[model samples]
Target: MTIKKWFKSGSPWIWLNAGAIAISMIMVVGLLSLILVRGFSHFWPAPIVETTLTQPDGRQVQLLGELSRSQTLPAQVMREAGVDIPSDIDLVTRHLIKQGNRDVWGRDFVWYPETGMDEWRYPKEAMRLERREWGDFYGYPVRLKEEGRTVAEGEKLWPELQQRVDRANELFDEIRGIERGDIGAVNHRMERVRLEERRLDMDRRAGRIDRASMEEATVELEARRAELADEYAVLQQRLDQLYQDVRRDTLVGRVMDGREVEIPVGQIIRAVQPNDMSVVSKVGLYVAQFWDFLSGYPREANTEGGILPAIFGTVTMVFVMSIIVSPFGVLAAIYLREYARQGPLLRVIRISVYNLAGVPSIVFGVFGLGFFVYFVGGAVDQQFFPAALPSPTFGTPGLLWAALTLALLTLPVVIVATEEGLARIPSTIRHGSLALGATKAETLWKVVVPLATPAMMTGLILAIARAAGEVAPLMLVGVVKLAPTLPIDGHFPFIHLERKIMHLGFHIYDVGFQSPNVEAAQPLVYATAMTLVILIVMLNLTAISIRNRLREKYRSESD
Candidate 1:
């Protein structure tokens, strides 16, 4: 077939492969875009309750909450339900669940957000709250009643008032039943008093007034006193229970009474702004900065989204790795290309370099831990920086060690790329340069290296992209989840190379899973992840641009 005919026939397969690749790229781009947009959007201004509450100590605190009411959900709801709970404010939740009131369970603040109900993870015995300090710091908001007003009116009293009604009913039931037991006991005692009175009357009527009957009358009176004491004890118990129920706020009981009172659940009061422009400006800036950092590419902790540290670490490590590996790789490539005889030994060396590339990265991580960090770095630090001692100064995982390890790991790629670029140069060009009074070393430095730097840079860029995103190895070496201090700081020389640093890659893993507050940490996780992907793209783009420029510079020489 003719060349044009062959080109036309191959177009279908080319289009198919290109279309598949395009769709995949679109999908990847779309997912990353969504994560970036949503993660940043969370930091935008959200509605919050604004109030300045006065504490018992006469100090005002600015508090923020999602609910509208100052009278937050009352903790006394437990007591109102006749639940014999402990005094621990913390333990109050368990008994609250035990009461099984739909309003308390469904609408209470404690566990509503996490568990969607009042069910508590901790047992009542394990929970404890300081009693004396438990005022507004503890219960539903009960604003101080005015001089004239005693009962809080409307929805505010609904929950607590219902509690009182329940208390009254319980007390009424016990009081009404007093005749069944205590009243009977009282009656028995009263009978003894009557008998004593009758005996005394009978004796007097007989004109004898017997001493035995008078003594019996006194004994009968004592029996009546004992019966009356028992009835009083029973009545007192009922009154105490009534008093306990009355103290619980009315909101809980009222809510249970089928009242649609908007009981404050997660109520928090914050300071209200007095419409000042300066305050508005500060608020605006805070919101804008928050969104800006979250939306951008990954950086160091001290920068926007803290992606700068990642970028600096990644580029710095790669440059160091290339510096360490390039000379060694280029030397080995040169020996194979120009000096080495085509023997079995040379072929074996070539095969070994290729095999090294295929070794699992984790194996390198293990080797770095045992050989490079502990053995080499420990010896260096032991001899030099002893003040930062015992903590494995150079003997630990760090930028220097990561650079060296990756250099060894990616050496074969540099070797292969350099050798190929060398081979591509026509033998005639080398001969002509040497013929013009240039030695082999001079020709290499002046001619070959300049021509091949672009391809070598390509190999280095690939090595960098892989190293920057590495995590499993970094964790083993030195990427701590929480470093007490940043690796870079302002002290004398400024960059604290000895200090452990935060990495964007590690930050994503730590914040997403290991953080104390998962709800709050999730946005940060997505923001970091989005930032990292963007960074990798940027590094690769730089490498591509360099390659294009060199290809253009050298294209004319070949023709």
Candidate 2:
């Protein structure tokens, strides 16, 4: 009767907890799946080729990207990027044209076909332009006659311009390879080696050799050096100007000037490369960038930058901290459960653990910044990385500090879980092992810890999940907006601890809030947000799977 009552009373509470957990799992999973779908959607879209036709009549047929109106670009877009135009001549109009300029329909691309460069969906890699029959009229209409201009004159200019650009680019590449003093460095070093030999020769024939001949040799060398140097400088300057014209990123006007007009992240990033002209290509670029944004972590120097290195930096620091904290947390839990006297002190320690858990993550961030970044890191840098000092490699918020802070924040959770797991093993288990002549240490290693592995792992997974989502602590410690270089590479053992890093949370915040072009960045921000959510969900799913497996393995049939 007592057993029946206990079972009946516990059933409702058990079902309630299970239901809550199930609901939460379903909600999070569904939301994350939706986000992942949307992010991936940005990739594959229908492909269409755009063209133009000038019939035997003077009428120009405009070929849009597709028959129906496309929300996509190059086909019906009136403004190819910043080049604005007539509002009515938009994507819908292009769709009307692509419908074969059908007389059956009042509006269509065929009747008034136009494959205008002005509304290019994307900059085509190669425009198959050749002298071909435009329905039988075989003449360049804009060509400049003896003293006249015709319809074909403008048409020929693009091919000519392309040729010139190719030649110019080739020249620029060659000249850029010529380094300052490269020729002279080799010559100068050789001269130094030959100086002693030359001295002897000169002494032997000082009067016999003409002074003018020596002067001429020196002048010739200098002239050759100056000629190469001038040619290189000119080519470099031209390349720099051309690069600037293409990207148009520097509102500075001069290299050192500054007065930035706010622009969106997508706009700026798109402008960085011409290949990002197509909708598909643009989508691809963003996906790759965001993937880097999501997976690697990101950071910047001051305000605007990426977060890949920061993720790397954070993970490295935390992994090290885990190695440091795991033993300490476990040992403390063991002593408290088995060795420490159970008294007021033990109760006070428990209270302290609770208080520490409640302390804000940002507080840990601050402490990490102050103690770990500054003092300990400063000391290490001063002793070993003296060359990089005053820049504050360790002594400012950084990876090491962030790890330590998170470790501190998570330590209590680990300790509390470990203690609980240790306590949960029936007293009989311990007594049974000891009764069989096993030492306490042997029991812990062979029995207690083994049975408690699942609980300990649960605590660890929770700690990791919490740490991965941590933003405030990172903000205080090492969360930078952008970083100049990657933290990992191959250079004499190769992990660069001094570098800053990026995080996805920080990236979404930057793109959504701090981006220069807020309007353009909106879609990308949603996309990025979706990506981050999917990643966090993936992590949680892995943890939950492990937990489920353990629960199935350990659940007692009697219970």
List model 1 lDDT by residue over 1-559, tens digit each.
6878968889878989999999999998899888888666544432332234343345553322233112223446645765333354432322111111223334222221111122212211111111111101112233212222446654454344334444544554465456444554456456545655655665677776667866776686776677677777776677676555434432221222233332221111111111222557547745755644643333222212334445455555556666888788888787887779989999999999889989988888788878878898889887764444555668788766766777778888888888888888787878889999999999887888778778777776777677767766667666665554434433334544444545667777777777654444566677677767777788789888988888778776656
lDDT of each: 0.56, 0.54
Question: Candidate 2's error at 125, in angstroms?
Answer: 13
Candidate 1 worst ten-residue window by lDDT: 126-135
TM-scores for candidates 1 onward, in order? 0.53, 0.54
Model 2 misplacement above 4 A: 1-34, 42-318, 385-388, 537-559
lDDT, residue 290, model 1? 64
Report RMSD (Å) for each prediction in the order shown. 29.7, 15.3
lDDT of 1 at 302: 25
Candidate with top TM-score is: 2
